[model samples]
Target: MRTPPPTTRPAPPRAPRRDLYAAGAAVLLVTAAVLVGRHIQGSRHTLSVNWPPLLASWDPHLGPGTPAAVLVAITVVAYGPALAVRLPWRTLLPVAWATATAWTFSLALVDGWQRGIAGRLTTRHEYLQVIDRFHDIPGTLRDFTHHILLGSPDHWPAHVAGHPPAAPLTFVLLDRIGLGGGGWAGVWCITVGATACVAVLVTVRALADETLARRAAPFLVLAPAAVWMGTSADGYFAAVAAWAVALLALAVTGRSPWAAGGSGLLLGLTCYLSYGLTLVAVIAAAVLLLGRDGIRRRPVLLVPLLAGLAVVPTAFTLAGFDWWEAYRLLVTRYYQGVGGVRPYGYWVWANLACTVLITGLATVAGLRRSVSGLLVRDRLGTPEARLALLVCAALLALLVADVSGMSKAETERIWLPFAVWLLSACAFLPRPRAWLTAQAVLALLLNHLLLTGW
Candidate 1:
């Protein structure tokens, strides 16, 4: 007769994970950024952004692309995970790219053609404005640094002055090819930017495993980063940087020397695209470290890598563009504008809030798991740890940029290259569907509600 089995007592309600706490901390950071940034901006006018932490304004409305954006979001939310899992690797890469392009294009169209795409890069502060300035390519390259200062004769616009000539030159060459103006530039950016998702998946599969790569694919496609990627040249920069890393990953893991050379070529281009992007080397180093075993086997890969690395700089030098001199002038010009007044104290932390917006709340939790993976010494070479190290490297690069004080605000768009990598951390979380929904909602809400100035 016996004693009844002791009551199970429901396994004592599982406590919240450290990931949730980390995510909560991120939410608080965003809240504090809004409240504090509004006060600082409204009172002293120093923050320089209408919306705290983001270069956007509070304008909530729907448009022609609203339905398309909503539909794309739902499609990805429902089918993305399954397709990412089942599609052949080759087929999956292009499909992921197409989906990303659709997501980015639809979000851009939310603001309509002219305001969103066709005119974004034609503004006074944008690259297309200076296409004529680059007519005498060699001459402009030689004199590019002269115009970075605010007081210089015919000084470049903020965007032009801030980046190396390679960035604007991309547009110049496009114009020469008969695809001038903001519309073609917009198409170029979105198409190339969409490849960033594929590039990251390729790298993850190369360095970690296909399983993690597959899990991460949907998150990359439906990233909140798409909001900014749709309009900014930074999106193009992100793709370039991602491919550079992906090529390096392949090269280290037994691909052809061509892969190494391509990686180096893109690495040089990435640095020239935006000075801040020089930090991409941080991520590159992580990839190499993770792939050190492969590197040890084929030490000859570095030859082609170094050879290709010389191509851009040598050509730029021959053409008269001096990367160092240009950056020095740009730093001086930085303080001549709002960068001088936007307090670092507020921005240092608020910038992380911008990161949260770009990466979404899911990434906050995902990063927690990424960090935990790094803690176990024995698992350092395991797939989870490899991916964690890669994600953390991107985070480190972004943190360095934030501390450098140059990126005070508008970082939601400005940090797209680094922030895109953060989305990969989403692969570590359980309940992929819920996290994916959170990502989609964040992106849709941001696109529908705010007029972002990417």
Candidate 2:
């Protein structure tokens, strides 16, 4: 009996070189995304702020883009914690926090300077600008604070239009709390808080996991779109938060009842601020279909979940004086005509086709019997590789449609998600060298051309 000792299995060997390669490749891709993103931000300055005049003509008392910005900031702050769970904290978090603070201060300074820039305190415009702190009060304080506090929401226009009165809710509270002493002070407070939230979200996300957070951290950090948009206004941040949460829920729980229900609820909430979340909902449905067995086992909760998802439009419809008009406005307004403008003409199409082809190839390679058997051998280990592959592919297709459907050549922001997923798809390949190299070359070249306007 004493001689009958049991055997123990050895731990799996660490693939350090492979891990290094993956990490290095991810960093390289993130660097490329950051560079392209910065170029897009610079392009915004050159576009001439025509919206200012349009907005003024429509609602002279409404102020400029501050309403939109404030709404988005609140949304960003609310969702910041979710992101913090997956992003690196010690280094990247501090930078995000500091930048947000500086940005808020800058907004206040800019607002105050605009009065002096106009060189008179007596004019109606100057007087209003002074009172409002040159629109910076709303932009820096209300919106910025909201972004830090709330993260982002979908369909931001509702809160901005006073339909929900959320923005004013904050304004009223600040007034009562003696936080609204001066427009600039409110702006600074909101901006700093919003910025801190952004950092916290990134840090929290990184701290949650070693492998994923490490890889995703840089892109989230360098994603100029996320930072610039959150800083610029609150809606963009809300959209990002919605997308991030939806993905997180899916990744953590797979086809569990909580996953579908939670994801659907978040999608519905997101619909309030940004309609783009509808696409995410569509993808989630596709995932459910592919995993129908697992999804159906939780049928008792299914009907309610579906009903909740319907609330997005239902709530919006009720908001309008006439539900039909509100529904129509939500559905038809943003269709600036499809067919994304690409100056490269056929070249862009060729690039997209090639990108899709490569993605398809990698996806197909992962479908080998070996891969399938490995997944089946350990059901709890991977939980259906085919489904993951399908999701990855569906995500890629959606990105193609998303980018290609845009009406502007400078719609690179819409295209970022596609680019990110394309790289992610490549990582799934067992032999990632060829796939990664191809994607890197294409991404680098196209991004450079897009940035340089070549």
Candidate 3:
């Protein structure tokens, strides 16, 4: 009898390798760009900007290094329980919520306490001014619109004159409840921080799967962007816009008509909150287009979504203010402000570096992998592809803002909204724990080493 043919075994699946080279190249490119851009900008302008000192004392009582130590300790304590336990997917939300709250409160604790919450809340400077007259909110809103549309000097506060009414509505609500001050600002930070954490998880779950969402939770809690989430109103704006994207993702996956409508309504509100948030529409559209039933379901989704979106601007119009005309004048006003002060050549690349710093090196590496996967048509309809598209759309929006020179400074805080989506890139990292630790280190360094006026 002929000898039996030897059987060959198929090779085991290969684990994906980390793209360190790509990540290193990205870092080098950003560093080179920042150096070159600053050189050119300094050569042309007087450079009167009050940049934060590279190393500054954040808390006198604790000392500079103490704040960094405290931040490191807080991050460890916050993440310890979750890391120690094997949590069910459903149970991760509460843990994530608590971790997010602690993370933000810890970062803001020294500043909020040292500055005196009331002083922090009530003090007005540059772009942000405390609403000294709460009763005038309505009139302020009207006048703000008028200033934007007709160039009438409403004598409005810089914050009011510079942004849509929705921007100040949060503070107005806080003031109504007798909760205005730096202390309340801390509370607002924790509240919105937790909300943003939950929104991020929900969006990830909606777009991908529960397993990925659970994996993403720890990273979100320790995000380098938390350095700003603790003190910026843009933190809350990030939460709102994140949920809007989450709701839209759920709608695309056939959640409900109501979800679609809710997404549109939130998106509309975000536009009124910050003009830059309008770019999130690109993200929403990407989700809709990439979905399995996108074409057939577009009408059902668009109808209620558009109607819900129209409500916000429609109400403003009825109040005798047109959003379009207001936005038009705001563009001119924007250029006349810091947008004109900072040259585009410098900010365009510098802003990108800031984004890379905020999002973490490992996350950027993952983003590179995701984009490469897209170009080669690997896993085209997979969850990873959808997430990659979402990230790309968000980055595109930031690029547009940077190119337009509408956002010239303090992007580390102002870009918190976009950072939310970018954090999703962490889901693709090979060693998430290492990346989380790196992110924590970066946050500590930022909070301790820099004294931001914002």
Q: What is the TM-score of each candidate against the true structure?
A: 0.96, 0.41, 0.84
TM-score of 3: 0.84
Q: lDDT for each of the candidates?
A: 0.89, 0.34, 0.65
lDDT, candidate 3, 255-333, per-residue tens: 4778888988898888888877888888777777765485375566778778888878777666655566667777777
Between the candidate structures 2 and 3, which one is better when assessed by TM-score? 3
User: Clash number for every model?
Assistant: 0, 46, 3
lDDT (C-alpha) at residue 343 in model 1: 97
Worst 10 residues of 3 by lDDT: 3-12
Model 1 ranges with Cα > 4 A deviation: 1-16
Q: Across residues 1-454, which tens digit of lDDT does each residue of candidate 1 receive?
A: 1222221111112212666788889989999999999999999999889989788899998877788888988998899888877788888899999989999999999999999999999998999999888879999999998899999999999999999999999999999999998999999999999999999999988988887888899999999999999878999999999999999999999756999999999998888889999999999999889888777888889999989888888899999898998998888999999999999999999999999999998999889878877887967677888899999999999999999999989898889999888999888877678888999999999988889984
In model 3, the Cα lDDT at residue 241 comes to 88
lDDT of 1: 0.89
